[model samples]
Target: MSKKVIHKANTRGHANHGWLDSHHTFSFARYYNPERMNFGLLRVLNDDIVAPGMGFGAHPHDNMEIISIPLSGELAHQDSTGNKKVIKTNDVQIMSAGSGLTHSEFNNSKTDQVNFLQIWVFPKEQDITPRYEQKTFNPADRQNKLQTVVGPEKDAENIWINQDAWFTLGSLKTGFSEDYKLHKTGNGVYAFVLEGEVEIDGEKLSKRDGMGISDTENVSIKASSDAELLLMEIPMR
Candidate 1:
């Protein structure tokens, strides 16, 4: 087993748009912080809460793999590729903005807020072809266990990307523990807690806290409370 590397990132970058409140766990465009740039190939992780009837306008992207996980409410997505969809809690969406693509996301409800996590990862190879996909997963599948949501397989239940990385989600009951083995020897896992508390690799992580662990074959997680967590395993270098 390789040595484990651990640290709690200094959370930075926050923008409140009256309708949308967002927090950047890593450096993002227009919210740059060199010290919090990235964790391995996990480039961006944005925690967003969109007020009813509001969301991001149409935007363009290129050469990046994007994943959106909804925590609550509903997200309406449309793209130049002629795709239109609504994503709710337990739903996952991925867009391979290979070469280039244009898209827009909005909250579909007018009376409730929508909270979601938007993540971006660097692709192993760039400029392939633009693609989009979305899937609604059964929350029970992640109850007290990790469920693989994204991977390099076309047959995966969720969206597929162009890299060897994998994304998993888990919801642990209080006092429950689970172990996750890394997907690749040279890759690392970035764990993010969405609710409750968790102990990972001997470190404690509270709600909204994140940690990156690499150079290890596996890591264990013990929940202090009923908790929801996301783990992204990607290349380290």
Candidate 2:
């Protein structure tokens, strides 16, 4: 049997700073909920919208696997590793803050606001060499199929992270369906609804809603409508 945990879109922690509005799916910054600290090794899932001409200043992170995905507009990124680039839609970025690093992300468009997801997962090992990687995914490739965007295995076409995790994205037409198989036995899967509607396992999820399930080999995803979804399989311990 499979167990599930749910996070409703409206129940997430929210913070608006005039220039930036953020929603935390899990406990983040000043938003603390002991029960919502994390889902297995998946620590932070933040939905952020940065206003035009406004962004976050440089900050520090260490021993965390950071992944950034832009949903709209452009996000300008800079880091102490000397990696500076602008990421737009379909672009996924990973930063291994092994030992330590300072980074900043800003809205690249002076007129258009930027909306993105900033995720944090605890690394399997600590104090290794800091690194960064970014890849562009074709939306067509994910049409009706799960596209492997981040995983432990290095891919010529897909991006990989430093942890024992697998991340997939899918865009489905109305009434379409799919099954996502877990890569590791002890890993739990987090299904995040990006847009439209879907049913994961047996739970219906709308935009920004999330569900976590574990102790299973595969999860069923059926699109109730045209949908964009993200699946993350992460270690339980």
Candidate 3:
């Protein structure tokens, strides 16, 4: 049997600070829900929209695998490691805050708001060398299919992370269905709907809804309409 939990879009914690609007899927900052603390090694999932020319100042982090996926507009990134870049939609960025690092992100466009997802995962090991990587993926590659964006492997395609985890994105047409097998045993999959509607193993989810499924080897996904989906597979232990 599989264990599952659903987090409806409206149930997420919301914070509006004029320049930054954020939604938390787990306990973060001022949001405190003991039951919604984490999904295995996946610690944070934040959906954020930043006003043009506004962004987060420098902040420090250590011993964590952080990932950013821009949904729309452009995000300017700067880190203590001397990396500066602009990421737009279809780009995936990962930062391994192994020992320690300070970074900040801002909306690159002065006339447009930037929307992105910020994710944090607990590292497999602590206190190593910090690193940063960013890649732009072709949207057509995920059309009616899943595209691996980040994983634990070193390759020209996917960005590497400090944990035994894989992040995949899917762009599905209405009536499309697919089976997503677990990359490793004992790993769980968290499916987050980015747009449209989807049904995962018979459970329906709308835009921004999240579902954590564990104790299972695979999952069946069907699109009720044209949809964008994000799947994060991480170790449960």
Candidate 4:
């Protein structure tokens, strides 16, 4: 494994397009800040809140891996590859914009607002065929343990990506603790807390807080209260 490098970034971006409010945890296109460009293979992490009946128009992408995790409310996704679906809380969606693809996302409801997380990762290779997939994950599966949601195998019971990485989600009760082993020897884990509090490798993470740890076989997490979290293991240089 590579040495661990922790990034405790402050909320660094604000972009309001009237209907969409986005917060950038890392620098993104046209919103570049060299120090916040990316971490390892993890490229983008955006917290988005969309107004009712509003969303992104069709946009094009290529050679990138995109993921959407709804925190609350619902999202309607449509792509050129003939995928049209509504994804809600506890649901995960992945789009491999390989070669090229166009898609649009909208808030599916006309009343309540929508909130979600959008993540982007660099692909191992370029120019493959574009694909789209979404799945509803039972929150119960993560009540007291980590539930693997994305890996490198379709037969692994979840979405698969073309990288030596794994994504897990968990919910812990007060005083609960869990340990996670690295999926690959040279990979690392990025722990992102969605709610409540937790301590990882002695570092405290509150809601929306994250930490990256590597060079270890496993890392420990202890919740101070009921908490929801996402752990992503990806290759490091």
Q: Which candidate leads in lDDT?
A: 3
Off by over 4 Å in 4: 1-10
lDDT of 2 by residue, 17-111 (tens): 99999999999999999999999999999999999989999999999999999999999999999999999999999999999999999999999
How many residue pairs clash in each candidate at the backbone level?
0, 0, 0, 0
lDDT, model 4, position 148: 91
TM-score (C-alpha) between model 1 and the true structure: 0.94
Q: Candidate 3 has what TM-score?
A: 0.99
CA deviation > 4 Å runs, candidate 3: none
Tens-digit per-residue lDDT, 92-197, candidate 1: 9999999998999999999999999999999878998899988888889989889999999888676798888999999899998878988788888998988889
User: Candidate 3: deviation at residue 156, Å?
Assistant: 5.4
Error in Å for residue 210 of model 1: 0.2
Question: lDDT, candidate 2, residue 192?
Answer: 98
Between candidates 2 and 4, the TM-score winner? 2
- Lowest summed lDDT over 10 consecutive residues: which window, candidate 2? 153-162
Query: C-alpha displacement of 71 in model 2, angstroms?
Result: 0.3
Off by over 4 Å in 2: none
TM-score of each: 0.94, 0.98, 0.99, 0.94
